[model samples]
Target chain A: MDAALTLLSFGPDGWGDDIATGVLVTVGLALATLPFGLVLGFFVALMKQSEEPSMRLAGNIYTTIFRGLPELLTLFLIFYGAQLGLQQITALFGEETTIEINAFAAGMVALGIMFSSYASEVFLAAFRVIPRGQYEGAYAVGLSHTRTMRLVILPQLIRVALPGLGNLWLILLKDTALVSVIGLSDILRQTGVAARVTKEPFLFFGLACLLYLVLAVLSSFVFSAIERWAAKSGGTR
Target chain B: MNAVAADLVERPPTPSRRWTGTRIAGTILVALWALAIAGLALYLVQSWNPELFDRYAGRYWSGLIVTLQLVFLSIILGAVLSIPIAWGRMTKRRIPSALAYAYVYFFRGTPLIAQTFLIYYGLGSFRPQLEAVGLWSFFRDAWNCALFAFTLNTAAYQAEILRGALESVGRGQWEGAASLGLSRLHTLRLIIVPQALIVALRPYGNEIILMIKGSAIVAIITVYDLMGETRRAYSRSFDFQTYLYAALIYLAIVETLRNVIEWIERRLTRHLKR
Candidate 1:
């Protein structure tokens, strides 16, 4: 136990800096993916909510493909496939450009796509809850359909959607570790490096788990607080 | 939250032939979606390599089997373990409940890869002690270690699902069953469980789908699951088709299971709808 303490102690002598950076990268990756994912999801939900059959079909197919495919596979595809596509595009310029795509960007894009697929479902449900009366009422008051959705419906839909989206955030936080496989120096990979160097896999991996647990616990507290506020706003049950 | 689930019962809205501006945007979106599909098709055709199918077909098949076996066994085993854990979580005993909560909290809070490495590489560091206890061989096998980690990880999730489902059952049913002179076991089996099963069905389906997707991680540790096989094939041929095919296979499995579960839910709840 004493030896464990010495090895893990903060400073250049230990792995404190590496692990700290890993935590930041993991959280950063998740945050970067959130708004873009949420917006994509909102559009997909709009597609589903639209009266056109083709639009609804488009939404259904998007969710089915992304949600069903493994997250790891999706990441691998984007990481490698994007590189290939980029290489081809550069070839058109008559110059050899070896582009090693950023692992962080690949992870963000892949996870954002997946997040959107799931978020669309939540958005669909939230959008569905707004009574048809609200739309008709808005139209009766001379509001355009676009303005009604933008100003009236979407605002109320957010409160109902908060809890579900919060759960997805937790899932996304845990999923950030998958980026490590593509050589992103995330928390898991940093701990893994520490384990290999010190021959203390148990110690470092245990620390990684504890770090993730703390993040998850903290997020849940924040989400529950938000949920309570949403409830007090009198939208969702 | 149930709000996250897609509503299968959503009625088709009444047809309106009005060419609203929103409808034009919808049409444009659908056209763009079709164009994307066409681009993907073009890419697939352009990248076609029939040689990959001839060489790694068997390896891919075997890897898929391993993935199926691992998830199937872990889910079944996890379900068994969950019964006691869920009961513990729901029980009046403070110690057992707290212990159960801690177990679930730890597993749910941490990433699966972290848990997997802890069991695989972490336990490897304890070989001498494991050998002393005669469990070294089991821990040494990557398949066994993956199974153990997955079982434990999934047990926590399954337990939470069970506890939530059971708790969602109304208190009036239990009192009514006791008044009917039914034993505690009978009340659960006859009066409460069937009702809870319906509520649990979708989440249970979600868990199974998640496990199927997550089982891909065991591949990174060299257990040669589908994702592992894809990695190997990709390394050998430097082709993206390998991962694409594996993705298709997984998508097929998830979609089939989803439809199956939805069908079962409908069939089981046919009596309750009226």
Candidate 2:
């Protein structure tokens, strides 16, 4: 027990700092992917709801392909495939530059794309729930399409979307761990390192689990609070 | 004219049909673009060394079989385990409910990869204790540990789904059963469970799809599942196509299951459609 504590300590002989850094990287990766995912998801949702059949088909295909593949495969594809594709493109430009993607960037893009596919479904469902009359109502009031979307549709879409998005955020948080496979020293990777170094796999892995649990519990509380707010506002509207 | 104006004022505007030459051209352009992308993908695949694929075909098949086995076994065991957890969650007893909640909370909140590592590595650290209990053999095997972790993790999700489905059953159903002098167990078995199963069908499908994708994580623990084989192939050949092939297989499995689930859902919910 004393040795375990010493190994986990922040002192010169310990791995506490490394583990903390890993936690930070995991959080950072999740945060960075969130907005990219939301924007792409919103775009896909619009395409899905578009009047044009071709646009709708494209959206459907995108979601189907992304949602059908495993997240690890997606990450591997982007990490390796993107680099090769980029290198080929550079060659076409007569440049000798080799474009390498770090695990962080690859993870963000892959996870963002994956998250967007699921998020699009959620957003599309939220958009569908609004009555057709809402659009007609906005046009009748002489609001332009952009203004109507910004002022009216966006607010309600978010309220309806809050629960699903909250769930996706949790899933995304957990998925950030997958980046460790590509050598991004995230919490899981750090735990593995610590475990191997100290020959105490149980201690480090258990610590990692406890840390993830804390993050999950804390984030869930925040989501519930936001959900309550959304519900309240939805009622008022 | 007055009558016509009043009619116009009362009626909703007709949805305008605005398909023009430009719209047709745009549609053609989109179709052509999609076709071009598909053709490029086909060309790339066709150009790859078929010999490599042929050589590794056996390995890939075995990996796929292992993946399917793991997913099926874990899902089945998880479903069985979830019933008790679901009951605990549904019951009025404080201790069981709290215990169930804690289990779900911890399992669901963390990454499956983390849980897999914990089971695969963490338990191995207790070899002496496990050996004394005659359980070292089980903990020492990567496959067993992977299966155990997956079963526990999926059980949490399945339990929540079951709890939700059970709660969604109307109280009237229970009252009606009681009025008929049916016992609680009989009511649950004959009426409530059947109804709940239908309600739970979609979520169950989602859980299975999720488990299928998540089963890939076991590869990290040195289990030669689909993803594991892909990694091995990639390292040997240094060809990125290995990952692509694996992705294709995964996509096929997910797509087929999705269609099957949708068909089942439609069949089961046929009564509500009318």
TM-score of each: 0.93, 0.93
Model 2 agreement with the true structure over B1-274: per-residue lDDT tens digits = 9988887786677989688654575477578768956875885678689788798889999999999999999999999999999988888999999999899988999999999999999997888889999999988889999999999999999999999999999999999999999999999999999999999999999999999999998888999999999999999998877887898899999999999999999998999896
Candidate 1 lDDT, A145-206, residue by residue in tens: 78998888887898889989998998899999999999999999999999999999999999
A110, model 1: CA deviation in Å?
Answer: 0.8
Off by over 4 Å in 1: A232-237, B1-20, B38-47
Local distance difference test, per candidate?
0.91, 0.91
Q: What share of the true interface contacts does candidate 2 keep?
A: 0.71
TM-score of chain B of 2: 0.88
Q: Compared with the true structure, what per-residue lDDT tens digits does model 1 show for residues B1-274?
A: 4765656558789996887776777678778888987887787788877787888889999999999999999999999999999999999999999999999999999999899999999997898999999999999999999999999999999999999999999999999999999999999999899889899999999999999999999988999998899899999998877887888789899999999999999999899887
Which pairs in model 1 have colliding backbones? none
DockQ of all candidate complexes:
0.71, 0.60
Query: For candidate 1 chain B, which ten residues in a row score worst on lDDT?
Result: B1-10
